[model samples]
Target: MSDSGLPDGFADLDPFVADWALPTRAQRYEARLSKPYDDLVSFYDAVAPRAEEAIAYLNGLDINDLPDDAEKLLQLLYSMILVSYAVNVFKQNRIPDSGAAFFDMVAEPAV
Candidate 1:
């Protein structure tokens, strides 16, 4: 019901939609690198707790026919997954000691 189109109870995540609801793996990866460590942590903190609830909500829907709002939510979840590594493991935006490293995703699954 929010302007971001995310389902109810997820409006708290509205502030992140423009940045985190990226539509592609490559974009999401780049987003992870572009954000500061603190920003990444903030995103993780907000989404981590709701991840399970989001999954369960999505599970009942038909993947082939998700609504626009649902799709955005899914994208946010994907971004969360990408951010988790930075927040939970790397503890930085980019991989430690791997300066300027990048992954060229030649192919990605159809959305």
Candidate 2:
């Protein structure tokens, strides 16, 4: 844990992402494409639930008042929160029958 007592899981994400071979966006996307269900479940298990604490810790801070580097780190931590939400709460893996693939934003609103 850091001096602030945050979980090492929250304090450092690089090791976690690297451990899963998903340290980069492209690698994560590939994991989703190649192992959609496994990747989502794995990521959720590793990062979610635990991420709530991290999110809460970050939320408790005054982001706007933080130093530039600290703010950037906080932003990255928030990204982890978002990813956990998507994978765990949303359970987004593949389209109903479209096979395994990464989520693509809808180009336009569904009519």
With a 3 Å backbone cut-off (N, CA, C), the pairs that clash in candidate 1 are none
Off by over 4 Å in 1: none
Worst 10 residues of 2 by lDDT: 14-23
Model 2 Cα lDDT, one tens digit per residue, 40-110? 56655655556566566667667557543334344444435445544655567434455554465445222
How do all models score by TM-score? 0.93, 0.43
Residues 4-97, candidate 1, lDDT per residue (tens digit)?
8998879999999999998899999989888788999999999999999999999989999999899999999999998999999998888898
For residue 82, model 2's alpha carbon misses the true position, in angstroms, by 6.5
lDDT of each: 0.91, 0.49
Off by over 4 Å in 2: 1-14, 18-31, 34-36, 64-92, 98-111
lDDT of 2 at 42: 62
